[model samples]
Every structure is written in structure tokens, then in C-alpha cells.
Target: MKLFKNTFLSATLTGLLLAASWPTYGFPLLIFIAFIPLLMAEQNIRVSGTQKKLRVWANAYWAFLIWNLITTWWLINADLFGMLFANLVNTLLMSLLFLLYHSIAKRVNQILSLIFLITLWICFEKLHLIWDFSWPWLNLGNVFSDYPQWVQWYEFTGTFGGTLWIWIANAFGFYALVQNLSRKTAQFILIISIPLVLSLWMYTTYHSTGKTKEVIVLQPNVDPYKEKYAIPNLEVARGLLQQTDSLITPNTEYILAPETVLAQNLPFGNFEYSEVRSLLRDYIYLHPKAQFLWGIDSYDLVYDSKEVTPSSNFVRDNLWVNNYNAALFINRNPAYQKYLKSKLVVGIENLPYKPILEPLIGNLMIDLGGTISTKTTQKERSVFTGDDGTKVAPVICYESVYGEYVTGYVKNNAQFLAIITNDAWWSDTQGHKQHLSLAQLRAIETRRDIARSANTGISAFINQKGDIISRTQYNEKTALRGLVHLNDVKTFYVRFGDYIAYAALPVMIVLFLFGITRRKKSPSYYWPR
Candidate 1:
């Protein structure tokens, strides 16, 4: 009973430490030692002569579920079932990952065990970025988001470097704690502080490299539940025009509106009746240099059988339609341009393993975007270019959460970044704030200024250094105009995306193979109880 009590308390302590290290309500320093208690508990389970494997997994699950619940409880404001599934499934996966590492510890030496643990975790995070059921909101590196001064090196290693740093610190810190205030305590302090000192020096001396450009971001403040879709697209366009009346200027090179601002589907290859275009074109003629960009629900009708793919919805025996959650770019030269949103939300935008999951689950997918239908996506990230050859990455709502995914745009010569989102679906919660924090990390990684526009809040201008230079409040109707720089120099992260995750993959595979083939009979080192 006493051992059980200690293990339970340790598990919950690890959870609280992790939750307390998150942004908006917590500090990043806690993350350095957050996993120590759990490590101790795992060590205890191995040494306490308890041979039950499920016991090890159960405690890990408890710890992970607690962390998931505390950090993302605000997801309930958006979708209860989605939130529940996210927590339940993610907890199981995380526990299994920890269990695998624990198994490897029994077969291999301590040093190899630690190495495998870090490599396996890094590989898991990398998989989360690409897989269909991706949800990387709690990646450990993100803990330093609110305090960018501590992670200025993200330009070189991206968020994976931060993840690596946290694990190394926790490993040494755990060792130091177990030694009872021994000489290694000083080593732990240096492990925690050395990277921070370097980051601070970079923050203080770094100069932004780019040409200054002005932009205007609009926040319509429309209620997503009742009125977002009920209104006509013409009315939405006119409302946008009215809001930007005073703010629109000749110096404004780009004008950004929130994602899905055009609730109705616009017919592709034809814009004769595009109300947003009509109003914007009339106004844009006055300031021909300004480009109007917005997120739209768009569709392309096809009778030609060759143009259709599996994503196309069958309208009749011979007709099909391709639906897109897309970005619409309007200017005099191109008149109208569209970029399909590629990275889709798991259940909302596209079903994970649709051919497999659909038959098994039978339509459990939910649409919190106010628009229905599983959205079809483009294969590649498309860069929207102006007449003067200014390139911008039109990042839609959920795509902003991905780190390496955003680098694809910069590689394609995107001079600046633009994020259009409708965060009102989650209402007033940490969901939107956490999202904005992720965007800041992207700004730092790419060294490109960001023009972020959102429906019902958080329209802002982020500099090349990840600072929110100017921003609007949540649940407010306003237009934000600010100057942003266009950078041609790409950061090391932008040049080679997530190299840490890449390097970790091969090491993980090799370690796993060795652990299975060369199992040791005796314990490497018994944990002192």
C-alpha cells in the first residue's frame, strides 16, 4: 500500500509539473524536471520486486492522461467527443511508448536505455507531424513559446531541439536527485542554464534581415454557431469592406481575412458573380497595388471523368464535384487565384484512414468549422504570388500548428507568411491562445514576418523575431494594420527541416534491433529504493 501510494503520487506530480510548464498559465523552467518523478516511479517499479508489466503501463497512463486533461481541457469547449477521443487515444499511445522504453531498459545497459528513450520519443513526435491522426499540440519544445528568449536557437534545430534539451536535463536532474545532493547537482544546473545563456545572447544581438512591408489584417468577429454561415457572401464581403474603409491604404501590399470568411462555396473557373471580388475589385481599383486575400469554401464542378479522384463527391452517374477549403487571392493582374489547403484536420477536414476507419466507425466524424463535407486537399504547398513577384504562404487555420510543414513554403520562396483562421469555433479559451503561441515559434524558425488574421479575435503582426508587435483582443471586431518585413535569408531550420527528428529515426531503429537481439540476463544497475 505504501509503494502504491508513492507511485500514484509520483505519477500525478509528473503530470502537474508538465501541465504547469505550458504557456498562458505556467513557466518553462518546470519542464526541465517534470519527468523526474515519473522516472523515479518507473525505477521503483523495476526494483521493488513487482513483476507485473501492466502496473508499469497503468501508472504511465495515469500520468499522461492527467497531463493531457489539464493542458487541453479547453478542447471541451469545441467538441466533447473529439476532446475525449484525443485524450483517451493519446494517453494510451504515450503509455505504450513509455512501456517500450522500459522494456528496452531491461534488455540493454543504462546508457543505451537513455539514448533509446530520447530517440524513440523524438521519432514519435516526428510521426505525429505527418500521420493522418496528427495531434502535436503538447510537443515538449512548445513549452518555451511564451518565453522566446530561451529558445532563440529554434532557428537552427526547430522545436525538436527543445524536446531534446528537456529530456537531457531531466535525465541528469533525475540522476542528481537520486544521489541526494551530490556533486552532479552542479552538472544538472549547467545543463539547464547553458542553452538559456546562448539563447539570451542571440536574442539580444540578432538583427532582422528583410525589407519592410505594410499589411492589414481583418477580424470580423462573427459568431460561428448561429450567424457565421447564415449570412450571404455578399454581406460578408461588404462588411469586410466597411471595416477596412479607414485602414486600407496604398502602402498596404497585402490584405488578409480570416479562414472560411466566405462561408458559401465559390464556383471555380468563374468569378463573374463573386460578391467579395465585385466589392473588393471596385475598391482595389483605387489602390491597384493592394491585394485582397481570404479563406473560402470553394468547389470545382467536373463532368470529365479524368478530372475526378477518390476525394470527389459523386453528384450523379456522370458528374462529380471537388470541394476545397481554399485560399482566394484577388488582385487586378491575376483577377483571382486559389490555393487549396493541404494539411487537413484529422476528423474535421479529412478522415484518417478513411477507407478503413469509415466502415469500422460509421460516420463519427464531426465538423466544427460550420461547413460540412470532408475537404479535399492539394498535393503540394502552393505559394501565392503578387504581380510584383512578392510571394506569400497562405496558411489556413489548423496548418499553423505544424512546424516543419510551414517550412515547405519558405523553401518554395515565400518571402513572408500569412495565417488565416477562424478560431471562434473553440470560443474564448486557451485553444486560440495556444494556437497563436505556436505561430510565434514558426515566425522564429523561418525568420519571416507574419500577418495573422482570425475571425472574432487575435489579428496581429508578428515580427521576424517572433514578437507580437501589434494585436487585437479576443471577441472583438477590429482591423489591424502594421508594418512587416519580407526576408530572403532562410534560417537553418528552414533550410533543413526537422533534422533532429530525422537523425533520431535511424538511431531509434538501430537501438530497437540491438535491444531485441542482444538481451542481457542480469540487470544493468538496480535502482536503489
Candidate 2:
């Protein structure tokens, strides 16, 4: 009877907590307090009868399964069959992790056990980031996305550290509210104060202001399926050129187009350099004042006949190699510079985990038509210089989530950010919105203005404070031309990268060790089934 009651309470609280994250049935306070009942249930089971360990582990697994399936049901949109199968696999993995957690918790002291759990959770989140079936989408750290102000410290520790903060707070808060007050109240108060102090520190540090620039973002509602198959390349190019004519105004300095806007690759370097040069010259001649930035598939061929040693040869250097996903910077003065995107999206763009999955999944199908696919492996940060020498760093679709990578660009002196994406793939689903929200953090991290252009979606200009000064509505083909701020003011996040979260790893290790050593301290606390 008691087992049923505890399981019921655990299931209910876990469900409620998970549901609080979904838009359909969400309550913010429920998100914070919901863990209390569930945590307490587990804590009570810790000191129960003989069979307590297995019972607690089983409930933990069940609760995690509930949390994941309830909150991340949207992953089903990936593929009906694959998503269901993936969820089952994920649930089982989570169950095993929880079982490990139960064993470790039993071995450690209370405080140490909490630390171990926190560390293990962080490690799991990190592992999910780069693993074979990597999906860092609904990481617990993202639950605090709505609470951006409290997460201002993410610039220093990254958002994974923010998850650690919340987990620690929950542990302390649970102790303060449920456990007896035996001078542990001070510890609880201190634990809760961490986020508060960091937020206050950030609030004070964000006072310095910077200059803003006028930029234009193009949200072209181009369906990849239709663009590639139904419509002719000429028709698409004509439409894009016509759209450019309609959108460009006197105030528009930087005009951004969505990814793959130029269906065909543009010639770069000295091969047909004259022709390549002529096309851009004509473009600049037509729009004599506007500085144009467009996403184009670019081709490169070296024609420099300068003699060099074998190793120093341009051919050997692969400088004359193939094309790249590139950004064209055409200034009104007839000057042009192209930048290739570096950080490619893992599965879609470049699969570093391709070898492992190739034998298993046997090539997943892209919904859009393509018999074979090419993997992009570009890793050099390409910076484009504006007419005034303002260096702009560009990240393509799905690359915005890599805040650490974006930080690397800022460190290398990329002033403004231009992210070209095609959200049309997801239609008007939460996928696009979530992707856009994640991009917002890039601005906060670097304190630079972001000019984002998306296909069939939310195009916006993000400011230094992570605020969107102007934004276009989703699912509309419209031009958003506004001044985007470009400031060199580097935030603390750039100085010290993901330090807070990484520091928790060692702390977690210590906690796990403590848990194992303290098993004898509570030998009489096991429960009978």
C-alpha cells in the first residue's frame, strides 16, 4: 500500500513537472516545486525498509521515462517510426543511468549524494551532445530558457552550468523545506543565493552601452521541396532578385538572404575570375549603395601561377579544392569577399558520427529529394569584412546552439553576427521557434548584434542584451531591414568559457566517492518489499 502511494505521488509530481515545460499545460511554479514531492519521496525511500534500494531505483527510472516522453514528444516529428524507437531506447538508457544513481546515492552521504547526482546529470547532458545519437535539444538546462534573467551567468559557465545551479538549488530547497533544520538552513540559503548573486553581478555589468547598425533580414518563404523540384532555378533566382529590388531601401546597409538562396554555386578565385568578377561588379553596379550579404553555394579554383615548393603549393594546400557553403559580401564599391561557414550541423551538415550509425541505420532518408548526400566538414572560422572593416561572423542553421563555438569566433575578432537559416524544414512548428530562441543567447554571450535571416520564419535583429529590437513573424516571406548593433564589448563569457559547468565535474566526482564511502552510516535504512 505504501509503495503504491509513493509511486503514485512520484508519478504525479514527475508528470506535473514535465508537463509544466510544455506550452499546452505549463505552470512556472509547478516546474520549480514539482521536484520537491518527487525528491522527498525518493529521500524517504532512502531510509525505509530492506527492499528500499530496488524500489527507489525502479521509481526513479519510471519518473525519468515519464519526464522525457511527456516533455519531448515533439521529437516524434523527426520520423514517426524512428522517433518512437529512439524514445524507447532513450528511456531505457535513462533507466540504467537512474539505477546507477541509486546505487551511488546509497553509498554516499546526503550532501555528497546530491553532488554525485548533479555531476552525473551534467555528464549525461554533455555526453548526449556529442554521442552517436546526439540530441541536445531538450536538455534540462533549457528549462531555464524562460528564466533568462536568472541565467545571465551562463556567459561564464554556459547553460549546462545553469542546469547544475538549478539542480543544486532544488537539492538545497528540498532539504530546507522537508528536512529538519539542523544548521543546514544556512547551507540552503547559500545555495539559493548563487543564482541571485550572479544575476545581480550581470545586471550591474550590462550597463555599458554600444553603437547600433542598420541591417536588413530577408525571410523568404521558399520551400526546399518546391524550390528544388517544382520551380525552375531561373524562376527562383528571378523571384529572389525581384524580392531584393522590393526590399532594399536607403537605410538598408546589410541585406541577408536565407541559406542556399543562390541555388547554384558562385565561382570564386582566379578560374573564370574575370566572369566571377564581372557578375559581382554588375550586382554592385545595379545596387550602387547597398552592401549585399547573401548565402550562396560557392565554388573555388586557384589560378595563381606563382611558383612554390611542393608542400607550399596551392594545389597541395587544397586551396584550389572544392566549393563550400558560403556568404557573398558585395559592396557598392564593386568590392567582393566570400566567407565559408565553419561549424556545420552534426547529422544534417556533417556527421562526425557517421561511421557508427552507417552500419546500423543504413542511411536515413532526407525528406527532400536527394539520392546521395555530401557531408560538410568545414571547421575554419571565416570572417567577412564590411566596407568600414567591421568583421562579421556567420553561423548557418542549427549552428547557433553551439554557444562555445560562437564564443571562439568572438575571440577571433568577429564583431557582428549573421546567421542564415532555413526554418522551412520544420514548417511553423516549435522547432523553428526553439531554434530562434537558442540563437538569442549568442547575442547575450558576445554582446554583439545579430542579423538573422531565415526561410519561412522568424527573422530578427538581436542586440547586446539578448533582446530582439525588431523581428519578423514566422511563416511569412518578408524583408526585415533594420540597424543591427555592432559592439566590440566582450562579455565575461568570452573571457572564461563554460567554466562553471566544467568545474562541477570534479565536485560531482568527489560526491560520488563520498556516497560510496558513507553506505555504513545508514546501514539500518533499507526497506522490505
Candidate 3:
């Protein structure tokens, strides 16, 4: 009973440390040792020779539950059910990974067990990026986003490198604490210092010599619950034009508006007939040199003969339609292009396993006054080229959270990135702030400047080095104008993308197999009890 009590306390301490070390509020340095208490708790269970696997799993679940609830409790403002599902399900997944590590530890040596833990966690993060219920917002690598200068090397290894760095630091720190030896402690300090030193050196020496483009980002600040969908498309267009007229100059190359700024569902086939498009065309006529990128909720009709994908919404009379949360690019050219949002928010914009689960509890999900079904997506990443031959990638709201998804835009010759989002649905909470911070990681990984426009949230210009040059206050109707460097050079991460996680897949398999093949042994004390 005493041991169980101690274990629960240790778990709570681990969760508190992790929550207190997260971004937008906490110091990231605490993450270096955040997992030490939990590790110690597991070790104590193993050494006690009593219900080792069950105790470890229980303790891990408790720790992860506390961590998830504290760090992401703000999600409840968006949807109570979503918050509960995310917290409970994500904690279960994390605890399962730790349970796998505990099982492996009982069969292998300490070094192998540590390696297995790191590999499995990285793989889990990678899986989170592509799965239907993706929620990579809590990925360990993102903790350093508040301090971009400490992660300049993200240009090479992507966020997976940060994940690897944090795990290695925790392992060393845990070992040093258990051994209580001066040499081990010094080794832990050295491991933590080397990467930070290299990152600082790289940050100080790096320089941007690319061409500069003047960009204007608009934050309409229309309340999502009150004024956004309630207002007509023309009114929204007039508001955007007023903001643009105040901020845009002759040298301004691009004017960006936030996601779903045109709340009216425009038909994809008759986009030119939309009043918002007409207004934007007139605005572009006045500023002939400027290009406009804006977000729209659109739909396209399809007949019976047309092949339909999973996201297609069936209607009566042998007719079906595809709904898109998309970005529209307008210029002097008569024809405009649209890029549909590929990555979608679970339960809100997307229904996971729609064929199976939609029949179960689909009505519980909120539609936010747009499409009642899953959002349609394009297979290829599209880059919009201006009249002067400069290209910009239109990254819609939730899509910006994906690292490799943005790389595909760079690979298609996007010189800069424009992110348009409507974060008001989550209210003025950590949800919007954390979303804004993650864009800095994208800027670093692709080595491309970012013009981020958010409705009722943060609107800012981020440089190629992941520094915010200018920003607008949340919930304020304003516009941000700044110069963003246009880089043609691709970083290593942009070229290769999440190589660390990809490499870990086979290594994880090998380690798992090796552990299973080894003779099963009782837990031996790797640390003094």
C-alpha cells in the first residue's frame, strides 16, 4: 500500500513537471527532466517484484492523463466531447507505449529498454501525423516552438530531431539521478548543452539574402459565433477591402485573408459569379501588381457517372457534391485556382471512419455552419504563381499543423507560405496561441517566410528564421504589413522530411524482435533502491 501511494505521487509529479514545461506559458528547460519521476516510479515497481507490469501501466496512465488534461484543458472551450475524447484517448495511447517499454524492459537490458522506449515514442508521434484522428499538437518536439532560436537545426532534421533530443536528454538525466555519481551527472549536463550550443552558433551565423516581398495580412476579427457566418459574403469582402486599402501599398505583392472569410458556400464551377470574387477582382484591378489569396467554403456538383471519393456527400436525384474548405488565388489572369484543405480537424471538419462511425454518433459533431459532411481534399499540393512569376503556397487552417504536408508545397516550388485560419471557434485560449507558435516550426523546417492570417486570433509575419517580425493582437480588427524574404533554396528537412522518424521504424522492429528472443529474466536493479 505504501509503495502504491508513493508511485501515484511520483506519477502526479511527472505530469505537473511536463505541464509546467509546455509552450506559451512554461519554461522548456524543465522538459529535459520531466519524465524522471515517472521513470523512477516504474523502476520502483519493477524492483519491488510485485505486479510490475500492472503497476507500471497504471502509473503511466495516471501521469499521461494529468499531463494531457492540464496542457490541453482549453480544448473544452471548443467542444466538451472533443476535449474528453482527446484527453482520454491520447492518454491511453501514450500509456500503451510506456506499457510496451515496460514489457521490453523485463526481457532486455537497461540500454536496450531505453532505446526501445525512444523508438516507440517517435513512431507513435509519426503515426499521429498521418492518422485520421491526428492530434500531433502535443508532439514533444513542439515544446521548443516558443524559443525558435534554440532549434535552428530543425532546418535539417524537422521536429523529429527535437523529439529525439528531448528523449535522449531525459534518459541521461534519469540515469544520472539514479546513479548519483559526479561523472554521470556531468555526462547528462554535457548531453543537454551540446545541442543547445550548436543551435545557438547556427542561429548567430545564419543569414538570409533572398529577395523580399511586401505582404499584407488581414485579421477581420469577426466573431465566429456571432458575426462571421451571420454576415453576407459581400459585407465580409467590403471589410477585407477596407483593411487592405489601409495597409496595402504599391509594393505590396500579396494580400491575404483569413480562412472561410467568404463564409457563403460558393459553387466551384461558378466561382467567377461570386460577389466576393468580383470584389477581389476589382481590388486586384486597382492594385494590378498585387495578388490576392483568400479562403472560401466551396462545393462542386457531381453526377452518377463521376467517380466519387470518401468525402463526397450524396444528394437526391442521382446527384452528389464535394464540399471544400479551400483557398482561392486571384491575380490579373482571368482564371483563378483553388487549393482544397487536405488535413482536417477531427470531429469538426472531418469524420473519422465515416462509413462505420457516422452511423453511430455523427450527429454529436459540430458543423460550425459550413458543410455537414467531411471536407473534400485535393491529392496534389498546389502553388499559386503571381503575374510577376513569384509563387505562394496557400496552407489552410488545420493543415498548417502538418510538417511534411507543408514540405510538399515547397517541393512544388512554393517560394513562400500563406496560412489562412479561423481560430475563433476555439475562442481566445491556448488553442489559438499554440496554433500560431507551431507555424514558426514550419517556417524553420522549410526555410521559407510565412504570412499567417487568422480571424479573431493572431495575424503575423514570420521570417525565414522563424522570427515573428510583426503581429496583430487577437480579437482585434486589424491588418499586419511586413516584408517577408522569398527563398528559393530548400533546407535539408524540406528535401527529405522527418527522416529520423522514418529511420526509427526498422530499428524499432529489430529491437522489438531482439527483446522477444532474449531469455525472459526477472527485473534486476539497475539503480540502488
Off by over 4 Å in 3: 1-5, 359-364, 525-529
lDDT per residue for candidate 3 within 32-136, as digits (tens), equals 988888887887787776688888989999999998998899888877888999999999999999988888887887778898999999999999999888999
Give the candidate number with the greatest lDDT: 3
Clashes of 1: 0
Ranking by lDDT: 3, 1, 2
Q: Residue 303 lDDT in model 3?
A: 88
Candidates 2 and 3 compared by lDDT, better number: 3
Encode model 2's per-residue lDDT on 309-329: one tens digit a residue: 221213455353343566677
lDDT of each structure? 0.84, 0.64, 0.87
The list of candidate 2 runs beyond 4 A from truth reads 1-5, 22-30, 44-58, 85-93, 182-208, 228-234, 264-280, 297-326, 332-347, 359-362, 370-374, 513-529
A best-first ranking of the candidates according to their TM-score comes to 3, 1, 2
Cα displacement (angstroms), candidate 1, residue 470, comes to: 0.9
Question: Per-residue alpha-carbon lDDT of model 1 for 235-314, expressed as tens digits?
Answer: 99889878887797778888899998988767766565666667887888888778888888878888999987766766
TM-score of 3: 0.96
Off by over 4 Å in 1: 1-5, 179-181, 520-524
Instruction: Give the per-residue Cα lDDT of candidate 1 at 99.
Output: 92
